[model samples]
Target: MNENPHPTRQLEEAPVHDQFDVTLEDADLLGEVELTTNLIIAASESDEHLEAEEIDRILGVVPSPREDG
Candidate 1:
């Protein structure tokens, strides 16, 4: 029960830019999902809730806090 009239139709006539645009969009979405999943795992394994400073450290945005700071 496919809704699209051209469900099996080929994209042979489609423009190259259109084809590659979709590919790039898909890759970007996949990367975003992967990063989010990894962050969630890191947070869950951490002893305490992830703070802004800790998150920055994980992302290498800032240096790790000093023990005496």
Candidate 2:
């Protein structure tokens, strides 16, 4: 009389963590992740691959080996 075909199968709740173990040092990494995600989204909107200027602009915003010098 069960509506579900797989009535024997039971679903379990996923584990939840109220707190994260992030540190101040992780802020820079998180920022980079945000930037990269935005770049990916913007690139997906365009039909063609990233242009030289666009690549340069991204590189300019992000830290690179050249910046270390």
* Candidate 1 CA-lDDT value: 0.74
Q: Model-by-model lDDT, in order?
A: 0.74, 0.75
List model 1 lDDT by residue over 1-69, tens digit each: 659875786657755465545444587788777677778889989998899877766655767678985
User: What does the lDDT read for residue 42 in candidate 1?
Assistant: 91
Q: What is the lDDT of candidate 2?
A: 0.75
Give candidate 2 misplaced runs (Cα > 4 Å): 1-25, 62-69
Give the range of the ten consecutive residues with the poorest summed lDDT in model 1: 15-24
Which residue pairs collide, candidate 2? Answer: none
lDDT of 2 by residue, 1-69 (tens): 549776686789998865785554687888888778878887988899988678668656554556545
Which is the leading candidate under TM-score?
A: 2
Cα TM-score per model? 0.42, 0.45
Which parts of model 1 are misplaced by more than 4 Å?
1-25, 59-69
